[model samples]
Target: MGPRFFGYRDRVQDELVREGHQVECVDDRPSETVWFKSLAKISYHFTDRIILHYAEDLAERIAKEDYNMVLYLGGMSFCFTHRQFSLIRKSSNARFVAYLWDAFVNCKRFGQCRDLFDDIYSFEVKDCERYDLKLRPLFYSNTYRSIPLGSEGYFDYDACFIGSVHQYTKFKTVSSIVKELEAQGYRVFKYYFMPSRVAELWCKLTHRCYRGQVFQYESLNTTQVVEVYTRSKAVIDSPQNGQNGLTMRTLETLGARRKLITANEDVMHYDFAQYGDVLVWNSDSDGISGFMRSPYECPPESVLDSYSIKTFVQTLLGEAPPYRGYHNDDCCNETEDAS
Candidate 1:
């Protein structure tokens, strides 16, 4: 009902609930029969109808609740038409806010439907600057807290990467870095999501060593993800092609108290980077070996607290700093329908 489908949303809901907000989650993408998903994938017109139905169903349920806020996390709009969104918007007197996690790729859809939300926030600062959207970077879940059980010895891998091979740049960067690490005799684990059966077979044939690690694109369970994050000495990340900002992987590394080796130069702007908690390097750089050998430096407690899920939730609710530019006084006012 909450963040079950999307882990980041779940973490935000958990933080909001922990802070004493009675939260009611309406899953925008409810589990449906496999036949339903297969049909939705085949026909664009049918997909629209299915999504419209989902939105109407969700709106009806939400209209019954007394929620003071309605936050539409990313991906809901892929299914919702302007008509569906408007119906949901009018369902309650709640302040409507949207936080976009994939503005880099979904910019046009967001731009076309800008007026649907009373206030909009994006993880990419460029979106905020270029589109007048409010700036809000991603945050790490509190569940990544340090374990005092001294369990570091249980893991055999020095570094690990868990993500997809959808983008060519992402796949090339990760594969190159991991291959280099393996050549250097450093144990590394990687999980890549192949887009098709053919792609999976190709990966299995070419990279025989990674045969068991590759899988089809789908969601990985949170417990399994956290287990890998906590066990590894360092986590690896590569930004999307043309991406200039940080992703949840950067936040996850911080949350787990593990060092990060990323291609994201944005990390240099943060305080933790100055203290060597995170290293910004590319596949061609020789610094990774030395960086991997060094013990991870824990960033200051204040820095850690700043990037926590609680802070992100508080800021979204307009109860803390790093505000999202929406005020309670103007929150109830309706904007022009840009549909």
Candidate 2:
């Protein structure tokens, strides 16, 4: 797994260890200095050189080890070149597998490295059909499952939103929703996180929507996110533009047994949404007040279990069948789901 900003890599590794597997965790990008990470977002030349060097080092190390499988999680395009992938493939006899929690649009380089894997999976339905990949949704860690649901009238806030503000559109949409929720007399908790001060300054200079906006620089850990969800009756989700897959937050909300207020209309087609566990909000925040006033309906226990990290790992390792419910053909015309 790549070292993600939210520490999901470590969480996935820990889950593997819990499953009784002797695992070797590799950081695809070990140079995690602030400047190096920031440059990776803007400079393809610099990023490519770093990845190339890392691949050579990794290939040499992999040649010395004997493993049954090489489970790669995300970052195929951003972290590896075709030649680099070939080098690693030549070094190890392990079955190479990849699981892309991100969409193809976000990882444009995925096509170049797609054929190198023995088995590949994606969270987005569109990507699965387009690339002939298996369909799988992102999973919620066990932390969310352990959260005790609050009794009626026990919530500290009516709703909560905790996510990064990556673009101006998401910032504007979230800000408007929060304002509307407050106007309706619902207590709301918001944590709009920006990656760094550098990003904040760049947005301030370029996007008028970000000027004077209050953004938290530090990201909330999984425990903190669970705490916020515990205190809130419902959680808000605004996906990035053109992304059509259920996000980690969406599954986490389900695991926490909380109501979800999302911008993704495609969510209505999911099994969990059939029970009224999710609300698809529009630009004007229509039906939000009534939705928030309604009681949250829990999906079936089987549906919830299918989305746990344990199930996800099992499916990735070919130990269990992939969860099947909604087909991508049913929602081909739909705009997008949450990211």
Candidate 3:
């Protein structure tokens, strides 16, 4: 697996090891040269070459190891071709499984190698229906659970938002919500992050919404994120356009026992939302203040346990049952999704 923005690859590996299984992780895009990394960001052809080489090396290594299963995370289409997948399959008796945390539109390359896996799972319901894969929601790492829930009236801020600026729409929505909250005398903590200065500069130049906005260059570690969540009464989530799956932040907020203010209405269908812990908002909506003031209703322990990392890994490996709360009859007609 490649290095995810939040070190999920490392966390997943750690969980597998804790479950008494030996694990070896190979970087999907392995390289030491700075120039290659820079060029790969701009050139798909160059990145494909790097991925092909890495796949060849990994195939050889897998042939030598007595592995029982090979789990391919998000980067399968970006990393392997049909030929390379065939070579790896021929070289190993291990079961191949894939789990996509992104939508099909974002990682459409998964289509090319879909049949190579014994089983496939996706976080997006649309992707599951379109690709005939199992539907799974993202998980909250144990780190979020470690955060002690603050007592009522002791929160440092009324609300908080800590996420990368992925698009102008998300940036604008978050800004508006923060502005509205602050205007109402609510102290809101905002941590807007951009991956690099170049990306920040490019967005500012291209989008008017980003022109005067400040963004953090480095991302917060899990500890820092948990700290921010711990200090706040609620977390704001602005999902990307066309995304239907719940984001890692949404799950983390639940794990931390914080109220959620989200743009995604699909959350209302979930079992946890039945108690009014989540507030669905839009640019024109009201009642945000009331929702923020409302006492947070904790979901059942079973509901929280269903979305934990342990359950996530177990379900992925077929050692435990998948969470059934994700599926609902009303979910099919929903126009918006989260994350």
Candidate 4:
């Protein structure tokens, strides 16, 4: 019924609530089922609503609540806005936690929120290096060796993507990636758009710049999305930061026991990758092409042998390794050497 979009905010809110933690989502837009049903379904298991444009009002609201913490999603301006943070600090009584997508690029925008956050969660290791500055490496939970949990070592799905591309770089990057996959004879379908309800209108207006495959693409529901990802042979599960988490697709895909090809090598290195040979790595530009020709298969028993969902949750909530200062000395030494 309102401006709906399926992004990480819903996932974040849903997770917090599932943990029985009270959560207040602050955003300028509303959740329209026509636009964000898949998002709500995948991320939230219960009823949900927007704050009717709680841009800065959330600050005062938080100040009055009895919450345990405040989680700041990546703001609407693309990076964390100073206004949002200021209001959060002004509004809440709980510990301030900032969840950012990219640690490298989006950092400069957190002039106030940076100091206000009690913990920071970044999907990037570069952010881990500065955890004392409020970085929480919670994304490094355990990796699994199996898929479809109950199903033996079999996945019916093929290749898939969970996150989306909206801006200039994102559009270019995602469209190019999909085109690249297509060039290699892979079938790719993406459902992410600006906002679900107004997606058509916005696309029509911005088509001159945000040109990609809109007409050819139609949205899919959450169940269908997870079904496809789990059934596929491989899922494109890495994040570009500012586009973080183990990636909802990563967890859901692995939970489904499908092979994963992701950019989140840091987590893989943290002991999750050992679960199976199903994981595909593509760090360099050319590596992606190689994977296109020879996609990796999802490993079954290995994922179970490596990590579990409980452990994954602990990591997300800051109960695992990758805590601040783990590799600080080495990083500092390396930096000094270069200088």
Candidate 5:
């Protein structure tokens, strides 16, 4: 699950693998999908019999290894299911943990796997307080950014939405709104589905809806996605209530020195929105879209530059304790009383 799935397992797992851990991933790849081209099509759910076979195989393989920690980075619903977590717990002594993106959005798996985890790792501090169980806070792998262009380029677009067609009403609604926004002279970009290069080439040949005037569907690799972020004036981010709240793109937007107009409620808890830097942008709920003519102005250059990966990673790793760095132009220092 690379650029297709938002906040994928690749870069994060690569970090682990680079750290010299023998990491084996039951990743977003299908059990049988060994080749890259195999991931080009739609998803196929694993049958129970197949899943059990894999589970037993996984259990046996893991049992042989000497791992002290088992981290579930939002892939727990698949890799470490309730049944498998239990099976592994019974057979393995590894500390099982999950890093959930959406602890509250639309929660069904909470009860099933709550006890299975030794700890739930997350970035949103408020969510930890909201949950019934006491969970330890691990700086979620969100303090990273991808700017489409590294240097200055005024390839201006109003906003861009870089995500796939998810099976959620709110997400669909957001897509529609983005299209409407584009229709009104605001350039927007997103994928109809998590598009593959092969599919993209097909669309270009067909002259289908992929080439819509207002909305541009780009199948750029993760690198191009960041360039889109940097080139565009802003990125339209929508936070799914409990699931993966405070969309990672929001942080990325800051990192790219781009503005973010997000309807995500959890983002309000962040200094990004609370401070003058990021806007409390809810087109549907906030009523700001009702009368608000133009989008909130982008923050100054150094404003978001300050919220860079360098500082974010440093702050998260305890290299530098969480210190509120105030920015007068579009930043959280105004919202939070920092001494």
Candidate 6:
């Protein structure tokens, strides 16, 4: 499988291979070289069709292959038209399935080819409710289990959140929460997409909002993230505004068997909450100290196994697994409450 962000595609390939299924992976992205990528990033602002040529080229390659299943993961900025989808379908006897992890923001672009896919799955609960799509929570790889925990002295912070920030209140809420935790004598190591002071000034000068960052540092890679997860006592989760579903950080915390401090109170309604693995804190609420002082309880092995990417891939391939942990109905009441 081709490498992608979070190594999610790599995890999928590993799981399918472990199940003894022969899988061939293909990448749809173009311009992997530094110079080409720089050019693409610059040209993207001038024309929406900057990536169209790449997509059409990839479609031609996909059309030449015959497979039983063609799965697309996380359609970020890729543009695929109906004609291209039709060509892909005609070329392969494979079932076209697209799994979108970022359905909330990318819906408009990804939804364009929704009818072309045989099966569509989204991580967002509201998207499923509104668009009649299947709801699947994001998964975590079992590899996290290899990281030994309980080494408190190794970390400088009690909790850490390494993710992108934005202009929205969700990210602003995170900054506030981090300060609150610090005031309560808890240490927090927070990182966002803000790269430099120059960039921040540029945004202000141009009157363009830095969409997902405040102060900038280079984002962590997979190895660096796993290292951080191993050292930290808990990971903080702050969902983007209007997104009711759990982020991958939630599942990653579960995989690492670490504690979770989240702004999403809806998580309290899920079965995983029954295990005491998570502490839900809202910006409007109190009790930051109590929750921080609470112990991290290890969830049952069954619970961990249920949410593994292995089981998720099996379910995707039409296998009935014993543990299908969270469902759309489980979050229905929470959704209603939020509305």
Q: Model 6 lDDT vs. the true structure? A: 0.69
- In TM-score terms, candidate 3 sits at 0.92
Best by TM-score: 3
Regarding TM-score, does 1 or 3 come out ahead?
3
Q: Count the backbone clashes (under 3 Å) in each candidate.
A: 1, 0, 1, 30, 13, 5
Candidate 1, residue 181: CA error in Å?
1.5
Score residue 227 of candidate 5 by CA lDDT. Answer: 62
Clashing pairs in 2: none
Estimate the lDDT of model 3: 0.79
lDDT of 4 by residue, 43-86 (tens): 42222233223434555566667876655555232222455445
- Per residue, candidate 6 scores C-alpha lDDT tens digits across 109-180 of 567778877877777766766776666677887767766767546566798988876444656667767878
All candidates: TM-score: 0.79, 0.91, 0.92, 0.58, 0.62, 0.80
Locate the minimum summed-lDDT window of 10 residues in model 6. 330-339
Model 4 TM-score is: 0.58
Candidate 1 at residue 103, lDDT?
61
Q: Which ten residues in a row have the lowest lDDT in candidate 4?
A: 138-147
Off by over 4 Å in 1: 1-4, 29-45, 104-109, 148-155, 193-199, 202-220, 323-339
lDDT of 3 at 224: 85
Stretches of candidate 5 exceeding 4 Å from the true structure? 1-7, 28-46, 79-83, 103-110, 123-127, 130-153, 166-219, 241-244, 284-339
Worst 10 residues of 3 by lDDT: 330-339
TM-score head-to-head 5 vs 6, winner: 6
- Compared with the true structure, the alpha-carbon lDDT of candidate 2 equals 0.80
Order of quality (TM-score): 3, 2, 6, 1, 5, 4
Instruction: Give the Å error, residue 320, model 4.
Output: 6.4
Question: What tens digits encode model 5's per-residue C-alpha lDDT throughout 1-339?
Answer: 212255455655555565565666654222544342343222223344554566677677778888776665653334334685566666678877655555644334444667877755344444544553322222223233434433224656656777653334445556656766766666676645534555555554554344442323454566667666656766776665455344566667766656666666445544445434454454543432432234344455444544454433333233444434322333233233321
Write model 3 residue lDDT over 1-339, tens digit each, in one string. 544546777888999999999999876556736676676566546667666777788889999999899887774334456776677777899988888877876664557778888988787777776656787788899988888777777899999999988587888888888888888899999999998898899888888878777789878888888888999999999888788688889999989989998888778767788878898877755888678878888889999988899998998798987567764664443312221
Give Cα-based local distance difference scores for all models: 0.69, 0.80, 0.79, 0.49, 0.51, 0.69
- Model 5 CA lDDT for position 236: 73
lDDT of 5: 0.51
